[model samples]
Target: MEIRLAGIKEFSVADGPGIRTVIFTQGCKNRCKGCHNISTWDLNGGYIQEINSLISYIDSICPNKKVTISGGEPLIQYNELKYLLKVLYKKNIIYAYIQATI
Candidate 1:
């Protein structure tokens, strides 16, 4: 499975309750006025990445093995995100958050 991403933060404390690996998923419907990730608004703008690759990287370097599926809006790519979560769950990785609006 593949996902479009704005960026990935391998180690981030601010995104979740603990040190987490944040997946900045691309595409958002709501153009919130205060959105920090202006670049992520475009659904086609970010790079395409294999979900396996992201999981593998997180497994290797993220000490907590925790992931935060953040976004422009995560639900924009629901199928890919779902697969990513399934893979992460199989690995016993602790996924801290999955943000979506509607």
Candidate 2:
């Protein structure tokens, strides 16, 4: 499956405890006041990426690193996120959390 992403941070400490890789998914409905990632609001703006490639990049960095699936709103691609989580889980990758905006 493919994913739309605003960006990917291969290595991040601020995202979670221990080493972490953050996937910044694209698209969001809620445009809250003073949003830092205003560019992620557009559903068509970011580049399309394959899920496998993203996982490969994460794996190449380290084994079983903590991952945070953050976005303007990650559930925007609910099915894709579900698949991504499954794959990550199989590889012993813990999903640290979802950085949700309410």
lDDT of each: 0.85, 0.86
**Model 2 misplaced regions, further than 4 Å:** none
Write down the RMSD of all candidates, one decimal each: 1.2, 1.4
Instruction: Residues 1-102, candidate 1: write the lDDT tens digits.
Output: 789999988778788888888889999889988888889899889999988888888889878778898888998887998888888888898765987656
Q: List the residue pairs that clash in candidate 2.
A: none
Range of the 10 consecutive residues with the lowest summed lDDT in candidate 2 = 57-66
Q: 62 in model 2: Cα distance from truth in Å?
A: 3.6
What is the Cα-based lDDT of residue 3 in candidate 1? 90
Give me candidate 1's TM-score against the actual structure.
0.92
**The CA-based lDDT of model 1 is what?**
0.85
Per-residue lDDT tens digits for candidate 2, residues 1-102, read 999999988668888776778899999999999999999999998989999998888878755578998987899999999998899889888865789876
Q: Can you give the lDDT of residue 29 in candidate 2?
A: 92
